[model samples]
Every structure is written in C-alpha cells, then in structure tokens.
Target: MSALKESQHLKIPLKDIEIATNNFQHCIGIGGYGNVYKGELLIHGKSTIVAVKRLNEQFGQGLKEFLTEIQLLSGQNHPNLISLLGYCDEGKEKIIVYEYAANGSLDQYLRRGSNVPALTWMERLIICVDAARGLNHLHHEVGKHQTIIHRDIKSSNILIDNNWVAKISDLGLSKLGLSGLNRSAVISRVCGTPGYCEPEYFSTGIVTKESDVYSFGIVLFEVLCGKLCCTVDHDGFQLSATVVKDYYKKKKVSEIVDPILKEQMSSELIRDFSKIAYRCLHEDRDQRPPMTLVVKKLERLLAIQDVLLKAAESTLSDVIKPAHPLVREGGNASEIPLDISVLSNMRDFVKYNRLKQFALRALASTLDEDELWHLKDQFYAIDVDKNGAISLEEMRDAFAKDLPWKLKETRVLEILKAIDSNADGLVDFTDFVAATLNVYQLEGQDSERWQILSQAAFEKFDVDRDGYITPEDIRMHTGLKGSIDLLLKEADIDKDCKISLSDFCRLLGT
Candidate 1:
C-alpha cells in the first residue's frame, strides 16, 4: 500500500534570499511569530522590496503551522486581507516573503513612541475601521466557504504601511467556521496571546466567534488607550483586568479610557466607542455582535469623520500651485524602471540574443539529429575526474571550491535529485547527460504536463502578477493552513525568495 504523502508546495531557494537580504543583515524586527528580515526579490526582471518572515527553527508552532497557514491565506482575496504573493516551499527550511510595510506594527507606534507624534486621532480611528473591515471580510466577505476567526487580535497583529493603511497580519493561530459554528469545526492545541484570549476559550477548549470578539475588544481598548494588557500594574491599574473588567460589569467607560488621553480626545467620540466596546465585551457569547456589524458601524464612524475633517481643512487652506512635480493630486507612485543596458554591453546583449536565436533554430533544424544526443554529452563533460559518476558531492566541490561561503549539502542533494531519475543514490554520467538532453532535445514531447500545472500554481499564488510567490500568497491559496513558511524552506533548493519552474517540477513530481 502506498504511504500517505503530504501535498507539495512551492518553495523559495535560500541563495536568492541571501542576495536579496544581503545575508540577512537588514532584519528590522523579531517577534514570537518569527524573525522579520528585509529583502528585494526579482519578479519578471523587476526588483520589489519584500519582508521575509523566517519561522524560528526550534519553535514547535513554526514546524507544525507554516504550510497549512500559507495555503489558506493564498486563496483569500479581500480589501481587508493582506495580499499573498508567490511562495517558496523548499525542504525543511521555511520562509515567507511579503510586501514590506514601512510603518511597521501598530504596537511599534503605541509602545515605542518613535512614530507616535505622527499618528493623529483621525489616523487612529481610520486604523480601527480598516482592521474591522479586514476581520469582517474573513468572517463574511470571503467566497462560499467557512468563515475565519482571527483567534489572536492585538495591536501587534495589525501592521501599517507607508501610506498609513492598516492590515491584519499573523494568521498562525486562526480557525475556520462560519461564525465559529460549523459541523466541521477546527480545534488546535490551545494557542493564543495572553490577555487577548476570551475567558471562555481560555478556560474551556471551545473556540467561537465570540472569542474573536473578546480579543477584538481588547484591541479596541488598546487602540483607544495606547496601552498593553498587563497582569500587574506596570503602568497603572492593569487595564486588562481593571477597566476591561469594569467595562464588562456596569459599562464603566471612563475608567477604562487610556489616562494618557486626559483632555485631548473628543468626549462624544469616546462615549460612542465606549458603548461599542461594552457590547464587544458582552458576557454572553451569543449577545456579542458579529464582525459584520462591527465593521459597518466603524465605516459609518469613519465616513462622518472624513466629512468633518474635509470641511475643517477647506476652511484653513488657500489654493496654491503644486510644489512637488511628482506628487500628482490623485495619482499613485510610478515605478522607477532599471535600464538593463547598465549591466550588459552591446556585445553581451548581441551574444545573448544570438545564442537564444540559435537554440530556437536548432529545435526546428532537424527532426532526428543524433547531434541532440551529442550535445547532451557536451553538457555533462564537467565530469572530467573520469569517475563515470557525477556525485552531488563532486558537483558541489567543483562549483563551490572557489566560493567564499560554505555551500549547503541539501541544495546539492536537491540538484542531484533533479538529475537522478531512478531515485538512484548517485547521478551517473548517463543520468546527467540524459537530464541535459531532456532540456534541449525533448521539445518533441507535449509540454502541457509541466506548463499547465505550473501556470495554475503561478496564477493561484501570484496575486500581484509580480511573478514571485510570497508567504501571504501561499497561505491564501492553501486554505489558511499553518506551517507554510516551514514547507517553503524545506522545498527551496537555493535559498532564494522564489520557487522556479525547476523547483515547481520537483514539487509536482511523484
């Protein structure tokens, strides 16, 4: 009987990752979820900056959750949801590439005070609305499938980009069900950030949409107060237990408002938010409003705020000619294209074009040329040690002997596996020759087998048409399975932030 096999996933090679990240030198942040590093990935010859979330090698959550999470996230598309690019599913090494958010986590602004001066109240209110909309999409806007519940909702889980748009991140501990009520309910080993967890779920094992509301309530309180939930009175009153508890009790709204806001906040807005917060913290799970209601209310609030702000701005400003040439009133930023001629001389481009043309011409030159087989031999002539064997070890030594860093043994093994057809331990001269010949002379065979599967996976994962897979895409496509990052790392042959056609073929292989 055949043993059950894990589904194959796309992987990013490690070498490409090294070049993009400058050897992981520009890591901007680290968290319980994972270490986040900065990198640039090339998609269709265009370089785009991305954030690389590297799951901790030793974290059990990292090992169990990387792939499942990526697949789920990849298939989902909503204005509220973060976009998943393509992904890399190498063997045993997992990494997720994402669109970099320059403004970083909401927690950073709230806790660090570094960018706090810039976060106006209007921006904060908008952030809350944006977050609620994303949650609403997960709960109701997604296609005819089960609803999703973000088990962990906290300030840190919300990310902001350069434009100050808020997005929910870290789907590692989420669950699937319509309002957390379904026959096919999903339950995991109890996991969630403390203080944000619902008391019922924390005490019992049952997870429900009410649990998510409880967490969202915590986030709402945090956003209003700019404070973290603490067990002890590190700041004052331990907001999680005191004000949060009081709000739950008799709607003691004023007690829970962040003391830091003293006189700066609007009383009416605070009162409105306080009422919503109380509703969110309802003791009876059934009484709590769904994400849909929450999102709708938040949108109405934002609309009112926008009208008021625009009217206020209109009164203070006088029209003047635009000072910044590139700052069009309603246009988006354009990409500054890199000229390829900068890297190649006229002679090189001509030589490259000529070789490609010659290759194409050779394909139709002769239908039955023994020259195809001979050319295969020329490709494998690197086995000059005369061992009649092209061991992966031999290949690695040949290629990396002059390089500065240690070449990974696993990568060489993957390359060997690609060339070795019979699951053989070694790649003999014949095997290498056959592999080379297949690439050049096997055009006669129908290309549909590889092309169709490849295109499907690419289209499924490449949401941005950037021609590169990202962790977000992997999660969306795989139905929100966790451990996607780990799977990508294992499948990545070269440690690059991409899974090429060659890598895709390996995953598709039986």
Candidate 2:
C-alpha cells in the first residue's frame, strides 16, 4: 500500500456510487481492473459531474488494485493527472472516483475506424507533450517526491476533456522507482500490456523511467497509426507477435498509417514519428531518446507550425474590398463573359478561411478616410438598437434589406470583432468605419494584395461553390448594390459592356 493511503480520513459511501451508476445499470465499459460506470458526483460541496470507475468485485486481480488505488493517489495533486477525489470500500465492493472527462478515453478518438475528425499533427504533438509533462511530474518535477512510473501507459489510459486536454489515468499498475532503491527493482515485475510492454522488462523484470518511456512511445504510435498495437489478421484468426514484428520491418511506414488520415496528412510528421517509434521499440532499449528529449522535439514542431494555424483562422473577403470605379447607376450591366482558363485556383480558397480575412485586412489598409468613414456610418445607421454590438441575426437582416453591411454572419462577426478596438464587446462608429476602409484598401493594392483580396472576394460570394470567382455571381450573393450595373462599374475595365478575365485580374491586381 502507498504511504499516503494510510493517512486518509474520507471513505465514499457505496450506496451513493451505486445510485450514481443507476444501480450499475449503464455499464458503459469494462477494463482490465474493473468496469467503468458513467456517473455524476457532487464534487467539493457543489453539484458537479464525474465519471465513476466501479472496481469489479468478480476479478481476483481487482482486490489488489483496490488497495493500490488508495496508496497511489491518496493525496496527489496534478492537473495533468486524473484526480482521485474519493473512493468507496463497502464490504467486498470497491470503487474509485475520478474527475469526469466529458470527451472520454483517448482511444475512442484515436482508434482505428473512429469517425471523429482526425486530430491534426499539431494536436497530436500537444497531447504527447501534455502526457509527458504529467509523467515528468510523477518522475521528478513534483518537489522532493519519489519518482513514480505508470506501467500500463497506453492510449486507453490517456483521457481527454471537453476542451481536448489530455489527462493520464489508471494508476493501478504503476510502480515507484527512486534513487538508492534495489538495483534489480525492474526485474522483479514483468507486468504490463503486451504490445506496449518495454522489451527491457522482458529480459530482466526491472522497471524504470525508460519502461514508461517505451510504453508512451507505443501509445504515440497507436495514435499516429490509428491502429490497435495488437490485432488479429483481417478476415482471419489473430496473427502472432513474430508476424507483426516481421511486417513492421518489411512494410513501408506510410502503408500502416490509418487510411482515414492518409489522404490529408503531414508526411514529414508521419515519417518523423515512425522513426521515434522505431527508437522506442528498439531491441537494444538503451538506444532510445529520453522522454524529456522526445517532448522537446515535439514542442519544437509545434512552435514551427504556429503561424500556419493562425493563418487558417481568417477568410479572403475579410481582406479585400471590390472597388466601384464609378458610382452605382441602379441598373444591371451587360453580363460578363466567363473566361474559364483565367480562373485562379479555387481549391486553395476553401483550404483556409484565413486568406479571406487577410484580404479583408488588406482592403481595409487601401481605403481612404472618406470611404472608411462612410462605411462606418453605414454600420452605425443600420445598428437599430445602437447597442454598438452586432449579432449574427442583425447582420443577416442588414444584408437582406441592404441597410448597411452585407456580409454573412461569419464574415460580419469577423469584421465587428476586428474594428471593435476597445473589445468592450461592441462595434461603435469608429469600428464600423475602420472595417469599411479596410475592404476598400484591399481592392486598390498591388497584385499581391489583389490576390489576397480576390481570394476573400470569391470566398464571400462563393457561398455554395468550393472555388472559382465570378464578378456578377458575387454581386448577386452579397446583394451589395443590387443590380450588376454598380458591380460592373466597380469591376469593369476598358469600358466594355461585360467584364473580361484580364480586366478583372487587373482590378484585383492579381
């Protein structure tokens, strides 16, 4: 038993746990040590939610776990760790209470055939770093505490919260490893899940920080590949370990990545992680990088990708403003001919909403004070309640009635937030004007700026299509000036009845 377990004063009542689990009715899942019941508990004198793991009395091994739980988590406090708030030991019945993770186990999100949106490479790195930090705390960070090792580290043992933060869980099979301990401590217990088990432990049942490192590496591999570490032959009986090992050596690493993720993924990340997995699974065991180094490498990858992530957050219209070379005539102009060959790649447009935002920003940059102030006035005039803050519904109504800003809810929200300099939760006259001027400037910029502006304009108008840009089509979508005459006057070049692709390109400076 752990030393901390010996000093606890609170023992949760069995009846309460039973009631929370609906008399053990739901039976959401079963595990090696016990069956987990999805239940709620009032935490810290406030009504709170939590997932209850009821230890199965039927399993002989569960009895040992019951005791170990008390010992391992008696008074430990770590954010990355699943909190063991309390436990119940009623007669032969035993249950461990854990902080409720709304997102459930990491396996559910990373396992093969999971339909959930695949986590980006950056997200995987984040999860790994968090898990490593948790282990680091257990191993050394916690002040003056003996290092602890989680023997059964795997994807299933990593839980995620509603916000997708990862938490290390299931400490039943953990071991304590500290300095001055028996040099042969690891060699004493050869216990852990097979696929994730450290090879060194098999040779000499001695466990150490490296053992946890090896297990974490396997979990990381499982997450990347989205496959079970151990699996049976497809449409056949289970395959042997020898066969799996041989396959690992013979097959190309890319072939093993989950098919769902293979289509759109970072090949560099996959290859790098594969090499890391190979290091962890090395037969020599001594060749693997330390957990700290592994974490550092992953952090470096995240740092390098921060800009790309931020760039994905905006749209093109947010960047560009279509310029009316002439004022509106209140009538439709001759239709512009579609020059299909001159179309910019539409696929790139859908890839990042941020481009549109950048274009809108560029457009704002090109606008003169008069145009900017006029747009701001339009926004304020349309703001009926004068709350200075705009909602999606209000923005929608404005476009439909041609009252002020004609932008989609998403676009409107983006503009409002951008100009609301004070961030007092509202867009005042200054904000409205600033946003308008921004659009105008984007239209008047050089080619590079126009490219960005064009992307944004297409995005704002291409509400249904994925790519391609049409001047008249956009005018109809935004209903900005109603008739194509005003739009053509804004977009037309060389005094033609219709707008040409080259002329449009000139207008956009693309």
Candidate 3:
C-alpha cells in the first residue's frame, strides 16, 4: 500500500469505485483476479468507461500478483499492451482498474459461437502479430528494469479493442526473468495454464522468455485451430501438443483447422504460418526463434515479386494473359492474325485493368521461351543501350517513330506504371515483357504449348489456388503496388473485387 501510494498511480477511494460500478452491481466477468465489472468513471467531467477488477478474498491467492501487477505496469506504455489506470486498497478491498476493451477477451471469439462474428484468416494473423509485438516489448523494454516472462500467456489474456486491434492483458502471473539475462531461471514451482505451458518448463521447473514463446505458440495454434488447447474431441481424443506435433509431422495440420477458417486461409499462408508457429513450440528451447525473429518472419511471410503484405492488407492486383491469346473468328486456329505493332500493343496495353497488369506481371516473370519469342525481340529492340532494362528515354524513342499523334508525357509514365513491378523507376525485363505482350491473338489458344503456359502462369500467380484472383491474393503471392484501384476499375468488370480465368479470357478476347 505504501509503495503504491508513494508512486504516481491514481489511488481511487473505494466509494468512487463502488459508485463507478453501480455499487458492484455490474459484474461483467469472473477474472483471474476476482469479479470483473464494467463501469464509467467521471474524469475531468467526462464519463470514461473502464473495467474494474475487485480482488476477492475467497480466491485469496492473488495479493502478491495484485501488487506485482501494479509495480511492473505503473510505468509501462505500449499500444499493444493494456494500460493500468488506478487501484483501490482501502481496507480489505483490493481493486485494480484498466481501460475497457470493447471487443472483450479473445477466447469468446475463438470458438465462433452464435453471437460472435467469425475472425477471418487475415484478422487472426493480425491479432497474433499484435500479441507478438506486445511480447517483444515485454521481453526487451519494460520499465521494471527486469526481463519479464508473462507466465500466463493465453488467448483469454488477449483483449481486442473496438478498432479490432489486439492488446495483451492480465499480467498477474508474470515473473521477472534473470537479473541480466532473458534465459532460464530454475524456479522451485511450475505455474501457468497447463496445456499452454512448455514441457521443458513444466518438467524441469525452468522458465524463460522461451516459456512465454511456448505459450504463445499454443495461442497461435488456437488461432489456427479455433479451439482451446488440449480440448477433447467427441470420441475423447485429446487435441494435445502431442496430437498437434503428430499432425504437423505428417503435414496434415490443415485437417484440424477450424472449418470456418479453412476456406479463409490460403494453403501457402497456412504452410508458412504453421511452420513459424510450430518452431515456437520446439522441445529444445534454444531452437525457438526469439520474439524479434518471430515478428520479422510473421511480417515477411507473404511478400511477393512486390504485391506487398501491406497491399494484401490494403493495396493491390495480379493477372496473366497470353501475349497472343488468339481471337476465334469462326473458331479457326490458323487464320487469325497475331498483333505485331508496338504502337497497337501499347494502345491496347492502355486498356488493361490493374488486375490484368498484376496477372501479366507475374506471368512475365515465369513465361516460357515459346511465349516470349516475339515479346523478347521487342524488349531487346527497345533495349538499345543493352543495359537489359528499359529507361523512359528508350520507351519514347521506340514508339517515337510510330505514334501518329504526339505521345503525351503522361502516357509514357502510365505505360511505365502499367508494367512497373517493385515500383522502381526503370522498366525491367519482367515489366516490359508483361506490357508488350499482345492481349489479342485467336490462333494461339489451340497450341498445347500456349495453353500449358497459360495454365502454368495462373498456377504461379494464384499461389493459394483459390481460383479467383483477389487483391489480397496478389498482395500475398506477387509483388506490385500503386494503381490497384485503377486496375480493378477497368479490369474487375463485375466489381466483385477479384478476377477469374474466364474473366482473363473474356478481357483478352475484347
């Protein structure tokens, strides 16, 4: 009590907390600390909502944790971490207050009950990313001057704000790690929610930052599988770490994923995320990547040849069309003429949607020798400097003789924007090949080689194999940015925000 009072913590009177929580009538939950209530406080004449946790003596075990929580968290500040506001220690009443999390605890949402909205694969990843960030800060930069191990890292402790951002909460069981190191401390007792605790930590009573890593790995699997750890199946088959390890070892981890989330996840996203997550649960604690490496791996898991994770989260498009997709006039394969003029190709290129550009960009990177025969010559012809990349000057000079009208400077930049992969100033081979590839050719479709190349290109771009090409899909598998809206505006004819194989054929046929 003296320690709390001497510090700058807001020491609210018991009467105020009682009034704020309507005389303890608004009990919202039974927390690890005690009964939790939702309430509003008058701060500077404004009614600010807060969560009030009043310690129950019958539980009688958390007085140490209550003080430790106050001591460790009073000076901490992080967006991913929950903030402590005030405390009440008047007589037997020991209460702690926190900022309200509108979305409630994550455990309620994981099961996807009738009342709660299902979390998408992307949302789950973002939440894990948030939790990881919080863990990283706790491990390295806590104001407590100690390496912290959040002994009770669990999904229930992860609170989601109204904005859908996740914040780590409930530090009552957290322990100070080694004096100068973030490694193992051979404590006399084992603590933590059983299923989430690491075998090494539990068996040997040794705890470290890696112990928290092990717990977080359980949370990751919870996000992936949408279940509480060690849950028993209908047949009483327990989905324990051993079960998960077996599934992982057999490469059948997907079989256990929550059915609701299964469709939302792309196969590659699942594979990469699972690999990183399972590594966190390694039996050898030394093998687990530190929180920093975990963050980096999670963030970088989905970047492409520049369809950014940011773009998938927010920005861009991918599409592959044959340089010469044959026009079927009376369905004849040999009679249709292939487009050969750069001016005509450039003019048609202007007609493309961002989705189309995205697909072709990915396609260009993987195009076969047969597909590139004509476009390859055109690329070399424009590369007079022989630098293997096309400068804006090369572009202007190549079409300088052919355009019946003066090429608008904007048109040149637009062409570059159309083909620009990675957003670098000059057009590389991939960009140039993608842009000049004619979208109009009917005779080429009958060629087994062209058909196979087309199929192969689609497979390359659609890394998730979801059939439809979405902005998120392109963002994850391919790498391009800027002008996604412009691309979709023209290319996504149905306005469904994704592209399909028939859509590709239909647009090229036009």
Q: Indicate which candidate wins on TM-score.
A: 3
What does candidate 3's lDDT look like per residue over 1-510, in tens digits? Answer: 554866444788899999999899988889766998999987657788999998987776679778878876777889899888888888888999888899988888875343788787777877888889999888877755567788989999999988988899888887867534445667786778889998887778878998888888888888888777776655565656777778877888888888887766556456667777788889988677778767755654322212223334532222111233334457332233333344445555666665566666655666668767666565666677778888888777654433232367778777766666677778888777777664323113344555555666666656788887777666666556644666555546678987776565444433
Compared with the true structure, what per-residue lDDT tens digits does model 1 show for residues 87-163?
A: 55466557777777777887776663455564566777888888888888877766675777778788888888778
TM-score per model over all chains: 0.56, 0.56, 0.63
**Native-referenced Cα lDDT, model 2:** 0.57
- How would the candidate models be sorted by TM-score, starting from the highest? 3, 1, 2
Query: Distance (Å) between predicted and true CA of 203, model 1?
Result: 1.3
lDDT of model 1, residue 341: 15
Best by lDDT: 3
Superposed model 2: Cα runs more than 4 Å off: 1-7, 115-117, 143-145, 180-184, 187-189, 233-251, 311-510
RMSD of each: 26.1, 19.2, 15.5
Give lDDT per model, in order: 0.58, 0.57, 0.71
Q: Which whole-number lDDT from 0 to 100 does residue 320 have in model 2?
A: 17
lDDT of 3 at 457: 64
